[model samples]
Target: MLQSVPDDGLLPVDTAQFRTAMGRFASGITIVTARVDDIDHAMTASAFTSVSLTPPLVLVCVEKIARFHDAILRAGKWGVSVLGASAVDVSTHLARRGRPLLGQLDSYPHYRGRTGAALLSDALAWLECRTWATYDGGDHTIVVGEVVALDVARSSEPALLYHEGSYRTVQETTDER
Candidate 1:
């Protein structure tokens, strides 16, 4: 039987507990990038998912306070590079707060997509998208995009996963079916 709780003008759980609970769900990591005014901005985001296949849509959530948030809004276009397990350093560097804005992508091999957004060269997959819509999501903005271009790597690589607040890699196993 399902039980219902009455509304009491209070959150069901505190932020820390909510975060811990959500952390238990494993998610793939990606580097979301945008270029505005000829300068590039990027953020490590796991809050991404495909929305539709018929339209080839995807969404990424960016904290309202992050600089990348504003840049993505202004650029109106962005790229997502689904990271492989070997790109932890790339993810960590991009996730750092207050990191230098200039020459940030210098260490990583990447190329500008058709939309002028940066895409990591060795990512498992690349997606270039144009902003389709935006919605308010409390502390974060939910940005949806219609994919304009995409590519997949020729070879398979272990996917980078985030769970329990740490980076993880998929373990290969024999097919049982």
Candidate 2:
């Protein structure tokens, strides 16, 4: 049964309930990075997806109040590092709020993308994108981008995933149909 809502049409569930419900959907994690004025800003995001294949489009949702949001808009470019299971520490560090502005990536092994965004050396894959559009998404902004460059690393590593409010990794099986 669905809960009744007021005339405002908003769902009756609170933010915590909504978040808890959404957490059931497992998703791969990625570190979205952008550079502005020689400083790198990054956020551990699971709200990322590929939108198109013809033009190679992808999008990442950023909280409106996050510093990376403004930095990405200003820079007009960004990088997405598809995290592997080994990069759990990298994700944890970047996911922390109120992290220092400078020297944030100093502890991690990274390299500069062609767009000057930082790409994690331990990533399973890398993507460099140019901002193509931005749309309002309640308290977040949906920033779509045209993938300019991308590569998949040559390694046999499981991908990091997020589900049920915790980090997880996938297991491979040999059940071939």
Candidate 3:
């Protein structure tokens, strides 16, 4: 049976506690990309999920102050590149604050998707989406998109994962617990 919080629960959640608790759920890493004019921008994000099937919707949470937040709003379209284990370096770079504004992706190989958003050529999977909706999410803004194009680039590779504030990779095991 499900239990509810105490009736006296009037206090706000502790920030550190809330963050640590949320971090326990492992999630695959992704690079959110957008293009404005001729420049490409990308940010590392893990707060992405599929929201619907009938309309093929997906949601990505971008912090209000994130560099990509405003740009994404203006671009109207975005791309999600699900990173493989080999792309941890790329993830780290994009996740850093104050990262280079120009030539950020100079070292990596990529191509433009149908929406004109840059897609990492070696990603495990890719999704190109058009913004469908937006909603308030406290310090973050929830952007919903309708999937316009998607594909799996490398299905056999292990996905890059994040848990407890660290990067990890999945491994297949023959022994079942």
Candidate 4:
């Protein structure tokens, strides 16, 4: 038997429910990358967004402690590769820390972007950018980038997604039976 507990600072929410709430807002997946020394540092992120099209600005929220965070800051540039449907495995590699950055490159393909960031091939879109600002936001840092260049590849593939702490694929064309 369980006893009643105080609300304290908790939001009266379970982790699963919280994740599900956020998951309802579907988003594209991306691997943010920068060069750290001779290595290409990268991490998977689903928090990428476009801030303004006029100034060609975009934002990616990264955990403050992520290894690639400092690298992106140091490089003053980053690459955002919007994952295509087939890149789910690639996303997993970047999402987890301690995995070599080049490990994903082995199976997938990539080339340096305009700012010398790694613009992975087969992505639906890629943005090579120089940072405009860094804002402190709780556990994550909001990095706004000044897009120096963008590459788009036409594909019928669906975008990958993060939902309920799991990777999911998008489905097109709904049918009622």
lDDT of each: 0.95, 0.94, 0.93, 0.84
Per-model TM-score on C-alpha atoms: 0.92, 0.92, 0.92, 0.83
For residues 93-164, write the lDDT of model 3, one tens digit per residue: 999999987888888899999999999989999999999999988789999999999998747889999999
**Which one is best on TM-score?**
1
lDDT of 2 by residue, 50-162 (tens): 99998999999999999889999999999999999988898999999998989999999999999999999999999999999999887899999999999999989999999
- Candidate 1 residue-wise lDDT, 1-177, digit = tens: 245777888756789989999999999999999998899999999999999998999999999999899999999999999999999999999999999999899999999999999999999999999999999987899999999999999867899999998999989789999
Query: Can you rank all candidates by lDDT, best first?
Result: 1, 2, 3, 4
Once model 2 is optimally superposed onto the true structure by TM-score, how far is the C-alpha of residue 53 displaced, in angstroms? 0.2
Q: Residue 10, candidate 4: how far off, in angstroms?
A: 11
Q: What is the C-alpha RMSD of each candidate to the true structure, in Å?
A: 4.5, 3.9, 4.5, 5.5
Candidate with best lDDT: 1
Error of 3 at 62 (Å): 0.4
Alpha-carbon error at 12 in model 4, in Å?
A: 8.7
- What is the C-alpha lDDT profile of model 4 across 1-177, one tens digit per residue? 355778787656698887789988877899898876767888888999999989999999988888777888899988999998788888987787777656556566888877777778889999989899999876788999999888788888888887767777877687898
Evaluation by lDDT, superior candidate among 1 and 2: 1
Which residue pairs collide in model 2, if any? none
Backbone clash pairs in model 1 (N, Cα, C under 3 Å; residues 3+ apart or in different chains), count: 0
